[model samples]
Target: MSEEKERQAANEWKVGPVAFISLLVAILFFSGLFMKIDGMKWLSAFDFTTLGGTFGTMKEPAKNTFLGAGGVSAKAGFLFALSLVPTVMLALGCLEIFSHYGAIRAAHKLLTPFLKPLLGIPGLTGLALITDLQSTDAGAALSKELYDQKQITKKELVIMGAWQYSGAGLINNYFAIGSALFAALTAPVIIPLVLMFVLKFVGALFVRFVLNVVYKEDFRNEQ
Candidate 1:
């Protein structure tokens, strides 16, 4: 964590009820739950996926924009990743507004008690980690933003990457793809999700331990 950033945020905003509420709204906005509902499409207005929308198909339904269907290898991968640029930009824009109002600071303060102790990363990173549950691209973008702002150290960034990479976009990927195999599985659907979520923390902690023990000299100057 960057001490300067912490002090700056502390001076900029007082963590209060409004700040807390703002953080809640920001979290829900990216959580994907509100993107669609059985009978309530209006809620999509507040959802990140809905707000980000999707790329339009050209003549053929599968061929969207320059990236056509049945593509493979690195070229296809790059194009697929490129499509997420819009959502990432939009998420960062929204985050800036929330941060301006002190929601990000409040999130940092509120999550500090656990996040600092558990992962040794700044509490402000909670937003990014939570976002990963729904959108991997957005979470990664948020993490990059934090690093670019000099808010988290390189070690902290590595720890966060460990947490995120464990089950990147777990909720979205699981529910979307796993639902098809739900009937074939022996266990309940929620069980696997719970395990994977827990493992994200475990993986982060393990990485933290390794960094402290094996690579301590690399970050000797950092806190």
Candidate 2:
């Protein structure tokens, strides 16, 4: 490749050692892998669930959760959202630190190449995809902005939407909402989250393939 092309390629995939290290640290901290290591109980300091702590069990007959014990309506929904604030803030705060050291940039570099083959989308759309893990609304807004800016076609938006809609706000939602059911789960915390994330890819790819084949003529100009 030419010198200029080489430089551009280098820039495209640039992830410094510190950024990569930060990513690894963030993973280890949140993975729940070190929360119970025999004599190293202090490792809970690095664990998310351990540090985010648990809510008091509901004792108002049957005991499902602390959220009004299976209560319904807008009031119950508001309380449920209120309960999630602390954990979400704690998780996002730690993520912000990692991001300050460039974890997001590192993730973007590693994830960009898969966009085209996996989701039939541009590499630049990686941010919106990653953002969905934290906040569905932000990710949706970003995706819409991309479409409005003509960076991604309508077909690409639909495929991306399929991906996000399936698990929407995966990380935060899983930790905030799904964590309530963790007591009944036999598998570790990370396992189900991993499955959900993998399914997002599977779902998006299916949409992309359908768009290319069954709806081929509609996206004829997109190619």
Candidate 3:
């Protein structure tokens, strides 16, 4: 490639870890983690009295119990988030283990014929793509591996990007959060559940179409 072309390629490929950190910080700020919202009372409608005792009698309990409970809840949330860190690390570790055992290679061989034609992605890309469904950072690291190994070209990476950009592992998220947190029988649950699946399917299809269009020439060459 020419120097100009190389420079352009380098400029196009950039990862902004700081941007991700900033997003987390912003979410914490807005979610009343750092500062409470003015003039907004939380859980004001909760009928604690139904459990027994008037508001005045409950004042001490509310102050002591509620505050203590709030601390526990916050700690639990923090721990939940922390728990993901190790899970993610373990996932990446497992990926490495699979790679070492030749499982990934076997999977690539088994899946290539089907995926190559339908998605225009190499069979090997499937491993990374699958991992991406579990974790974005992990998927990204796998994609970087493919790039570094010359298994996928830069142009092909762009095409893959289209498909990977949309939310992956949505089904897992739905089951983990939607079903687990809120009982499936909760009021009007079916509609939201169905809608989430539909949206995920549509989003995946849309990305496939866009990638196909964007990489039409490259795909044609492959054909």
* Top model number, TM-score: 1
Strongest candidate by lDDT? 1
Which of candidates 1 and 3 is the stronger one according to lDDT?
A: 1
Candidate 3's residue-wise lDDT over 30-67, tens digit each?
Answer: 12222223564452222111111122345455355433
Model 1 lDDT tens row, 1-223: 6999998867775787878888999889888889768899899899887787865546775765455676778888788778778889998999998887778888889898999999998789989998889889999999999999999999999999999999998988898788899999899889999999999999999999999999999999985
Model 3: clashing residue pairs? none
lDDT preference between candidates 2 and 3, better one: 2
Higher-TM-score candidate of 1 and 3 = 1
C-alpha TM-score for every candidate: 0.86, 0.56, 0.46
Better of 1 and 2 by TM-score: 1
The residue-level lDDT of candidate 3 at 2 comes to 100
User: Which stretches of model 3 miss by more than 4 angstroms?
Assistant: 1-89, 180-205, 211-223
Q: What local distance difference test score does each model get? A: 0.88, 0.75, 0.53
Q: What is the C-alpha RMSD of each candidate to the true structure, in Å?
A: 3.8, 6.7, 17.1
